[model samples]
Target: MVVQNATENSIKIMKNLKLKIRKTILIVFVSFFSIFSTYAQFDGVFSHYMHNLSLVNPSYAGENNMIQASLFQRTQWIGMPGAPIMSVLSVDTPFKLLERQHGVGVQFLSDIFGVFNNQQVKLLYAYKYKLGKGHFSFATNIGMINVICNADSINISKLTTDDGYHSDNDPAIPIGKQTGVGFDLGFGLNYVSDTYSLGASLTHVNSPIISIGDKNEFNVLPLMQVNGAYRFPLDRDNGKYKINTNVLFLTDFAVWTSHLSSILEINEKYWAGVGYRYQDSFSIQFGLELFDGFRLGYNFDIPSNRLILNTFGSHEVFATYEFSLVRQKSNSTKSIRIL
Candidate 1:
């Protein structure tokens, strides 16, 4: 009788645990859908946001004192139909004029999901001034955002018609491909030191409006972000090993999210890390410095909610290169013929 009771108690505990999990997943999905339904245009989230700081903050351009270029790509919600795919290419360089430091950069982004495509190009400029222990940068960006919708590809039959509405005759739905373009603006401030950094930025400051069709339009909402990072040396003598912690917070005034990450660096050549996105996913990340001035990284996200049932996960990869324009002087003089 005791053995039978023990088995019964085990089964009951398992059932209760499953019930709790279901309730949590339902709450997450409802919250996500409610927030997304209210926004027409939203920025894509990146798991490797630490390396793509310039994408959100213009002041990050040229902060490294070297010419830098990067490419990044992400595929979200694997195995799910019409999942989001995004890519970005960006370059930045520092220059001096009239004994004052300045930065300039350009970025291109392409994002696609479902039947819609978004492309953007932006030019960034930043002015830097010396502060207490680090430099402060003030920056701005101007860009053009273009959106295209393949309205013909949308299946009208799949849409619900329960409100005494005919999907085929709805004038709000475009009968063909529709495109719209709008001007975008952003501003940022950043402070960086040898061991730490902090930044804040605002995207879509102008709240650009793009009209896709006669009745359909997109109202771009402004997003605010605050980010910071700190470094701790594990080996003080040689500084061969270290730990870096990063955090980012984002909001549109209605919905908010946060990301936290910590990474361990080995000999400045390789690193591994883990990250968490609040109410979303946990991620594993690793990377290496392939060669001088070049690095590559990858991140994989595991869903923390019901998305795990429908999708495998998300994947991201990024590559970056940095180099200085000034040539290094040779230690010894060389013959003209050898040169």
Candidate 2:
């Protein structure tokens, strides 16, 4: 009889535990979808796919055959006043020796809006792995984020009402600008098979609290990202004719709400794609590279929801160059040099 009673008690406890877990999950999901459903702080930052390669993941470093250098920029919520603008510069190189290959890389990132801006410098360490005929790598990154933020110059007139901005006369508002320090760590797994590749990464593990006084400690973020690309061969026997499409999906459960983009590249020289975002609006991008050495790109944003359109859709442009190239040898020894 005692054993029977104990069994009943155990079963009741298990049932209660299950109920609590379900409730917690439901509440979390609802909270996640609601908080970022409207205007968001970081929504404008991840509006384009190109920016992800340079700023979000260290695994993106030096995955290709040659040393790679890139620059990307984005202006969110085209036509919206006080929208955010972002820029990044990155360089990565692979080392090949003893039939094994690995790479190292670095990047610089800047994000600005209203009177605030954030700058980050990152270092990447990568380990190479072979897949079929091609090779790829998984990498880890560490960064120093120098947050040069100035809340004093916020230009309250431009911010208007209810977007989480307090009036200049508000007690919480400070009269002077302040600086903060933070750090970030990232891990990514990359793979390239045949003419296609895929990768996933988690970035910004150090989540710092940027607010004054530390009354409520808020960890800035930890993000999850997945990226993929495929290269297509065009025409018969046209060795130089090829097209590539790259897609990047991003989300930070805390802030973004929704951030995703798909970019299509036509041949090695040109690319164009469209993006959808809930925080601010939709974005379109176009880019071109000449002789695989000089690169240039542009993005256009159009406001989505109501009211924000009065400001204007934003425009951004970027330029990049590769100062050097690597040539692969065909294992030929020049006996003809004897002549």
TM-score of each: 0.83, 0.69
Per-residue C-alpha lDDT of model 1 across residues 90-153, encoded as one tens digit per residue: 9998899999999999999988866667889999999999999888999999999998777666
User: Candidate 2, residues 1-339: lDDT per residue as tens digits?
Assistant: 999999999999996776565555434423432332221223234444443354555665655545667677776555543446777777877677777777788888777654456677889978887767756678899887655436555443333333332343553333346555666787887776656667788777665454432221124577777777676666547635555555666677654444445665554567677776565568788778665456677777676766453756777776665543546474221110000
lDDT values for all models:
0.79, 0.59
Backbone clash count, each prediction separately = 0, 8
RMSD of 1: 10.6
lDDT of 2: 0.59
Taking every candidate in turn, the Cα RMSD to the unseen true structure, in Å, is 10.6, 16.6
The window of 10 residues in a row where model 1 has the poorest summed lDDT is: 330-339
The collision pairs in model 1 are: none
Model 1 has an lDDT value of 0.79
